[model samples]
Target: MSRPVMGACDACKRRKVKCDNANPCANCSISQISCEHRIAPRKRGRPPKGSLRQLSQEETCESIENATADMIDDSPVNSLFEQDAASDPQATSVLEALATPFSPGTLTTPPSVSTVLRETLGKGSLAAFAAVSRNQFVPNVAHIFQKLAAAVNHQLADEGETIATCAHKCVDIFMQYLFPNTPIAHEPTLRSAAALFDLVGDFLSPEDDETPSIERLRALTLITALCALVNSAMSQGLFSTSKSLTWLFYNASRATLRLYEEYDLEFPHSTSYHIRMWQSAALQNSTGRDRASWHIHGESILLAVRARLYDEDTISRLPQLEAQLLRVNFWLMYLADKTAAAFEARPSMIPNDYLAEKLTLREQGGQDSLQLDLSRPCNGHSLERRLLTGFHLKRRLWAAAADMICELRLFPTRNQVFLANTEVDRPDISGLVERYLNFVGHVDHLPEWLQSPQRALEGVEAHVAEYQAASFWAQRSNIMSVYHCMKLVILQKCIEMAVPEVVGLNQDPIFWAMQKLETSRDFIREVQMVPFVCFKVQGEPAVSVQPFSLTSSVAYSC
Candidate 1:
């Protein structure tokens, strides 16, 4: 057989099939493939048991020194490690301990540093270098690390309560104080979800393979963010606790939200918009108005758009509960966008044409298709529904204000152009005046509840508890603040634009100032009527900056 084949053909061995003792096996011959009988020799038996042995102390020292010396000679920056070793004799011991080699038979551990000193130096260097380098560079970032540590400790402290208990408390606090203002979450749904999250501890762990469903994660994110907001609210006054707890919850919420978004990006959900809105609100509460919060708000709007929230048909097709929430979120974002546009001078992300289209569609769709579903009879007895009604009324005012802002932006007044220093022809002031008048007319048309805080509270059900009544008052205060602030801003702008001869008597400086002063007085009076506890629970006033602006106007007029 061509000098009998020593073993199976390579093809037959590789295939792990039977092979005839021939140069070309029958299987390879039939397949017309190469059948070389080449194979590497295998080890005959197990390795000798006593081949490995521990090195003597002297031998170990010599080996370590030789290795260290070799590393030093081979490294371009050998001088650095030598200098480090010389400056701190202790480094030599640490290196020896860290670099100690283990016998093959012993339970081996990885070296603290890499095998090659060159690679270690290329990286951050050994622990020895860290000591000297830290003193030089640590001061620059020490405060940041200190703050992070404090936040971590605060989070860990937690008053000896578990996360579930804290989450439940946060939910209660949020529902009582913040929900009426935002009302983004459904009470029953949020409570049920919180209860579920309380039971599912494993889902909260990062290392767990059992991933939480999108809805569960969304609830968790919202709850975490709410916790941050509640802590921030609680820590408001001079006597209140430090903001470390707030920072802790805020960071946790952000981390949870990042994970939630990664999942959401693949399988989008409508409630993702709601969670994002809560996060944006929490960011604003904890960090104040910043690009981060604004960007979060923008993302919320994008989520809304993706959900077709602006499309009446799509909204109508959704379940009643989902449609209600989508509507609420849309209006809340619109109010925020308009508020930012008016105060912060940021452009509204929702295009005017889209808003106009939505309005037209709603009007054409009639009462059944109203954006807020105001035509649908709401139970007057339900505090949640009542709060939502108040929000709807507030939404109307904000929509009008937004329209006014858009109009003002389009046609710049003399003062606006002068301030901007743009070389443009003087635009007519009539459009501005008309827009201002239109906004005023819209405010006047608002129901009695919005026009007066007392009337607003009158709508509260008689059977409601004292705390529930307080929530209603708080909600009323928030909406009324927006109302008064919008009027103040418009009147202030008018005052700036007014010319004694060209402007009418109503648009005159004296008339505008009197109106502004009266509005400020009413705002202050309304704020005073709100209980001190309300302020404590609500954290910073909803229109905190507006009050100062009003105060300044009053002082200037005086």
Candidate 2:
């Protein structure tokens, strides 16, 4: 037979796919391989050169291995491999060699180890040893602690690292130091010795997971420090300094919260102190105005505690946790108001991006400038961010309160009802349904607006009146329900206060008008009436007959 065209396997020419060729192609040998069938090569102004050809599998393997080895052996290539493998688990030996104590550029290097440990511990090491104090390793322990403390102290002195950063490192060392059975002094001893609590409080980053016990312990210590600070500051008889102490208290609380967040923790019992104060302030005030403000502040701390105590599933067990967390919920309901108060107290602290717009005509140099450089400084930006945080935090608190009340409305817990109306509701909330019906069904959002005796509702009387009128209609009976509840609550509260007739049932003209209106029909179950329980004018029952804005009436008439 004539020689048949033969060619190498297609895989030989392409870098992909393994070739099954021997000398040329095994099949080609069986069928007689031919070079004529090979793919054409490039031509240099001449006819095409020889076509593709195949080689033995051994030769091909050798060639490929040589090419790979060459690439891998290059200086740059080898260095990359070394760098990558150094971090790999398989490279333990290599990493071990590199993991020595921190040098000048290393993260683990202690800045002040020699200063603190060598000097401080040397003073006490002999005492620790003579008594067989766990100080057997006192020298070593002190060395490590001193070095770390020195490094940390040095880092803190730089002002480059924040209190937060120092707190993190300090906690890490403390945890490691305590994890072993080594005999260190009590936590308080360490705290006092290091002045750590004063420096960092209890910084708990949500991201860490070293020791739950340590985190909780540190949190308690920080709380103790805070109480001490508050107590001491109060005793100083310096309001300004006391205010700063409160700020410190807030910072300490914030730091504790961070730790609680990290270790899935809660200080429910410790938090009860604030809760009681809040409830006392809230329930004690018949006007429910100042109580509401206090309640808001109380709620914020309560929320922080609650977040540590329970997770998402806590709601499923809301009833059981409610009484305990009600104090928290109570305070949460008023956080927005508290936040707003804080904001108002430091208006200058509130960052305003549009502040430059307030510049007077003369304040703007070379008037008629198209655009002024309104950009703020670094500090200004920081203030802006802080203000934004406060604004957002308040907004979140308001939203949370609304949602909580909505949830409370559905659950109908006794504590919630008592919170709604202190007068009719039992001190213990046993009359939940009755108090709830009297307060929630009738009060609506009026309780929230009861800031300064319904100042907010009064200013927007036209709006209030519109809603109040609609509430009287059968189709929109829900509104009327809430209004009735509120009226009853206000009356009960007034009676409890033992105000004379001029200030109680007989004192409020609106109450008398409503009484008259209710008596119009002997058997009337429903009546269309005004929702204002606290009237604007006194000794003028006719004033209730006229539609008056709560604000204008309260200020002008009263």
Candidate 3:
């Protein structure tokens, strides 16, 4: 008789071992990880897993695995349990983290190096640290970078369109549609091949092996992600298929870990670092990897705080453009991180106290990177000014939402508090409600182009006026997405907190969720209608995924 094929966790697949298919399968359980079943095992007698094909046609079966090609990772899942892997010691630190695939927002912070070291040494003494080195354990990406860089370089060559040309087109699509609030790679340096790599810095690892520059990797990742967005959009489907773009993203994300080491160094120089992180995280989040996105954004936060981007004194000292970029950057990270937490139904990484001084400072100094304000009687303020104003309005609105997430985080865990348990301590969402209410009221104050029933894709021409007009609509569309997304998140939390014993049964939170469900349906519908010749994506900027129907999704789940 043919032996039965079994569904194995990635770990066992790498080890070429068997898995029992338990939630925390025997191997993962032995490894002490939350087992995540990704690919289904081949039917008992059916052929083993076959090569994945380009998903040109929609299949009846709906799953990430079928919708997209299998992503390639650097190491086998079984590498962690290898005797040599244990000997290397560094892998032990990140083993638990990398092994865990779920991202529901309840994840603990990546264990500190010290914490990992302690675990690594066990009963051994501190000398063990002296003996352990990253060179021995760190995954070598020298050849990988060489291959990636060559692929990118080849693409950048002037075949059909130079990598620069094609990348710019993708960048514009990313800017106009994917993230209107956050401009993607507008640096003039990107235009020049010579200056581009210069800005990316030397990416050689300690082992003297070449690696893709942080900026280079980030740019390529964004371009691929943008292409993915455009391929999904109304540009009449400019790109043929999303297969290549999606494949590129899968490969690029593998290099993300090395960038974290740069948090100890290179990340702060380019404003694009965190932006890229947010964008990549969004792309990953859409792929059902909210936890991965959250982790990536957390790295951005670490870099931002270490660079003192949050300190008003440091920000005030920055150059005009850098200062403005930092202002917007901090808030975008804040909003992105907050959304990730709320989506997975977990406590926020950002604390409320961080905003106490920062919010007022942004409202006063930052003009959302537009560097202009025409809020007064139309002193002939340009459309760009209006767009910037909308950006500012979004910053202000999301700032409130950030506060809302932080305040809501104070609630007891979902399992800790029951609907009928009034005796337990729960968080106060009153502030969240008021802030969100205030945010909702201000949402209408934005220009007409930014509000509903407005055309976002009209006026397709090369002229300045035509571009601005279209740009206005796109920016407004992005702002609306962010606003509605925030509303959905806040209301979802309120609904979750509504206990028969605490807020009482049939309460306003539940009522608001019902009401917001309509908003979500409408917003998601409108979002789908926005036409892009290249790519389209949802959530990401705020929460980093297509959170268009977060409220409605939550409502249904309940």
Q: Which lDDT values do the candidates have, in the order given? A: 0.52, 0.30, 0.45
Evaluate residue 161 in candidate 1 and report its C-alpha lDDT on the 0 to 100 scale: 49
lDDT of 1 by residue, 308-379 (tens): 666778767766666666666666666666555554456667666677756322312222222222222332
Highest lDDT scorer: 1
CA lDDT for candidate 1: 0.52
* Per-prediction TM-score: 0.60, 0.21, 0.53
Kindly indicate the candidate among 1 and 2 with the higher TM-score.
1
Clashing pairs in 1: none
lDDT at 335, model 3:
61
Where does candidate 2 stray beyond 4 Å?
Answer: 1-214, 217-229, 232-558
Worst 10 residues of 3 by lDDT: 57-66
Q: Report the candidate with higher TM-score, 1 versus 3.
A: 1
